[model samples]
Target chain A: MSFFKVEHLTMKFGGLMAVSDLSLTAKEGDLIGLIGPNGAGKTTVFNMITGRLLPTEGKIYFRGKDITGTQSHIINAGGIARTFQNIRLFNDLTVLENVMIGYHGRLRSSFWEAIFRLPRYKSEEKKMRSMAGELLAEVQLDNVADEKAGTLAYGQQRKLEIARALATNPRLLLLDEPVAGMNPRETGDMMDFINSIREAYGLAIILIEHDMRFVMGLCEHLIVLDHGVTIATGLPVEIQNNPQVIEAYLGEPEGA
Target chain B: MSERHRREWIYKLCTYGAIVGLFAFFLQVQNQADEYQIRILNVSAVFVTLAVSYNLINGVAGQFSLGPNAFMAVGAYTTALLTLSPAEKELSFIIEPIIWPLSVLHLPFLPSLLIGGAFAALLGFIMAFPVFRVRGDYLAIVTLGFGEVIRVVANNVQSITNGPLGLKGLSEYTNLWWSWGVAVFTVFCVTRLVKSSFGRAMQAIREDEVAAAAMGINVFRHKMLAFVVHAFFAGMAGGLMAHLITTISPTLFSFFLTFNLLVIIVIGGLGSMTGSIIAAIIITHAGEWLRAVEEPMAIGPFNIPGIPGMRMVVFSIMLILVMIFARQGLMGRREFSWKWFCGFLKIGKRRG
Candidate 1:
């Protein structure tokens, strides 16, 4: 049995088939990449996996549990976490508060205990604060932990988004175009950061990226999609040389 | 204890001390002030309760809901029906006989208030399902329509609401103590809730619902929590307002009431609890103080005739000026924390 698997996942919007019969599996610490052209339904795949959209037909099994079509928060609580292509930090909240929100699902104390400031709530709150502080420190954002998240630099904001996703303590992490808008140096740094966290957290990562260099250099395995169909899947070197993958990207050499 | 811990302890002590001082002041005012002054204070305290709870949904949770007036009506009517004596119900319901369960079900003021609030919360819970299906301007319109629907029902339901004549001449149970005590409690609960993890989740939803859900924060549940809590407190405030004025009709909880609360929250700073409290007090008093503009005045040699409703015109202009100059309202989403207070006094490091 696979550690994580999506079997025959299909998503349809009215008559438009966004993703059809997409199936993949990952081991406990596998690093996989989903590469496609713009509008090839990459985000739709993430949305389906994260429960933002219900798949038309599919089975999602995570750690021997069929988590098909569950609510997004419940899916997240069951150990799947994702980041968006667009950074969606709680911009008005402080950096620390944004991370602390990631731990909200695992909160042991009820709201009544929080309202009354009971001993349990106090202890839990203290623990949450410390954990949030550690996450900020790990992300090199501890110096600005008290500052509003909106004021951070773009690279820092991206890091903060990843930090927040990690705060959910997920075994599976999905990255939607993790380095979408970045200079080469920043992209390299992000690749290194993703690698470090993948090893440190022992996570199975499935990332979507348009950046070919980042995807080929970092991902051990790759899947190429074209028009909602997986055209090729193999080791990174094999995928790069595959004729079908080339046809999908370069488009049939004009006359052929 | 460490320096930070000691400072926190002192802060807690000072907060309790201030609360005691405030209650003592309320006692003094109740004993010495005239009925009119006491009435104004009660009105302000009730506004505080309404504004703070209203902020939980509008400011904190960032949902555009306009049905608080309807919830208030539900609360006020529930309390009025529950607390009115059976003999009094007989006298008040001249058009149609009072309803069976309500006519015979007379209770003390406290329980009646609690039941009223609970009833309003139940209505809020029911409304959340349909209301949250829409967002932004659509949400405002839907909630506004909800308020009208409740008002229309109250107007037509003679057996339950005494039609448009409304309940009148009830016992004056909302004194300074009851009104201010509830106001203080509302502020305390809302502030504590906002500072909790649940509050962070709500704010995260306010920031971005998609991201909040992906982070394992239940968006709908937090929204429902905020809505129900808001409804509960607004209902309690309605109950207090009902007893303070000793009368309530369907007209009492109209679009105008909701509009007034919107003005209070906007002028107070959308997400600031302290801002809501200050704005409520200021707006409540300003409504009375600005009435002088409506009265005829002899300035130098010119004598102007008094114009009814002129107070509202001046109030609207003042609101316009505030919007133009201070767009984020008075506090601009910043709370009044102990550290900020000490910093303002130049006795500690500035922090918020």
Candidate 2:
């Protein structure tokens, strides 16, 4: 059975349709990619799935339960995490604390318990710190954990964002433009890290990327959108050869 | 030992030892200091607590709330009624409450402060339900309206607040130990909060609220907690102030009080708790020192006559200068850590 399902999802912003009648599924261990040209509403789809934006007409089922219209907190608690297209992080905080925010939702301490520094709360806080440290190590960002998150290079900030998402212990992770501003070498390293994380954690991922090269190799399933409409859906190989996908990408490149 | 382990241990030792030393020092000064200086120190400490708490909400969490005066008024009135003298209790009946009194509660200083803080926090939480609905200029206006409404209500309630006369002749026993103890506690609490995951979430909301919520920060709830916590401190400050002045008046907790606190935090730094405290101390000391300058300047062989309002005029000029030259106030949203302190001694810092 699919770990998460999005059926007939539609989102409208005032008079404009942001996500029009889209349906998709992410099963256990599935790696899906949702791609479109700029302004094709790709980020809106991620927003809807992560409960940042509610779909006007749709059902989202996570683990066989209806999660449609659920709040972002509940959705996160249900094992969904996302990174932003523009690398949104707590800039003033240290890198380690940014990842710690992701671990807060699953924290078992009551507010008073944390305040009083109960034995359990103290243990949990220590655990969370090391877990955040491990996640930083996983993303190969252990060196910059003490620096302000905003002071890091753009590529490192992107890695920090993904590390924060992973800290949520998510079953289904959504990454938006994960390698948008990276060098070719850094991009290659990010790809390897993402792929290894998927295998190690058994995570299903929905990737939204502008880079065709990485998305094609990373994603097993590709869903293409054009101006809020899903114009094409298939495996990456089929998508690369589809006429509509080419047209949506403003006609195929001459060499490709 | 791990580096973080050593750092954590040192932090704990300093904070705990500092807290105890602070109370001890204040207790020693209980009889030595003049009453007026003691009173002013007490007042400054109260504002110190208020400013730090306000920093938690506006500076750390990025919610601009101008309702500290309102919360303070609530606390003052609550304490006034709870700890009123027999004559004051008789007057309290003339000004009836929204609800019937269980009995004439004559509480001591600490219990009264706690109850007042809790009561003020309740009002703050209620106010936050709507205050946080808006941001920026709109939030400022709404919170200002809350403060005004509170003053208006207190003014209209003749039986309770004594109308324009206010509550007179309170026991007035607030001391340096109590005031600074709360101030130290406030700073400790906010500092610890900023160091924790919850504090990170608050700064996240301040930095990018939408992303914070997506990351499971619960922006609204966090904002409310910060607001209530700030209001709680403001109420404690109010209880201290009410006792210091011994006479409670609606005019006592006015927009003036709000602006003074705002000026302290703003001049300090928008998001710096440490800056807020340092700024509060400077402002308080400046107010005290300005008295020395209120008299006309006496240069060599020239007798400068005292100008009654010259102190205020000179203080205003200093405020403008601070704004223009050092817009970030003293600390500029940065905490004073051992590294920052030791950074002054560059070689020492590098060695350890």
State which candidate has the highest DockQ: 1
DockQ for model 2 equals: 0.53
Reference-based lDDT, residue B204, model 2: 84
Could you give the C-alpha RMSD of every candidate to the true structure, in order shown?
2.1, 3.3
Question: Weakest 10 consecutive residues, lDDT, candidate 2 chain A?
Answer: A109-118
How much is A94 displaced in model 1, in angstroms? 1.0
lDDT of each: 0.93, 0.84
- The CAPRI classification for model 2 reads as medium
Residue A172 local lDDT, model 2:
89
DockQ of each two-chain model = 0.90, 0.53
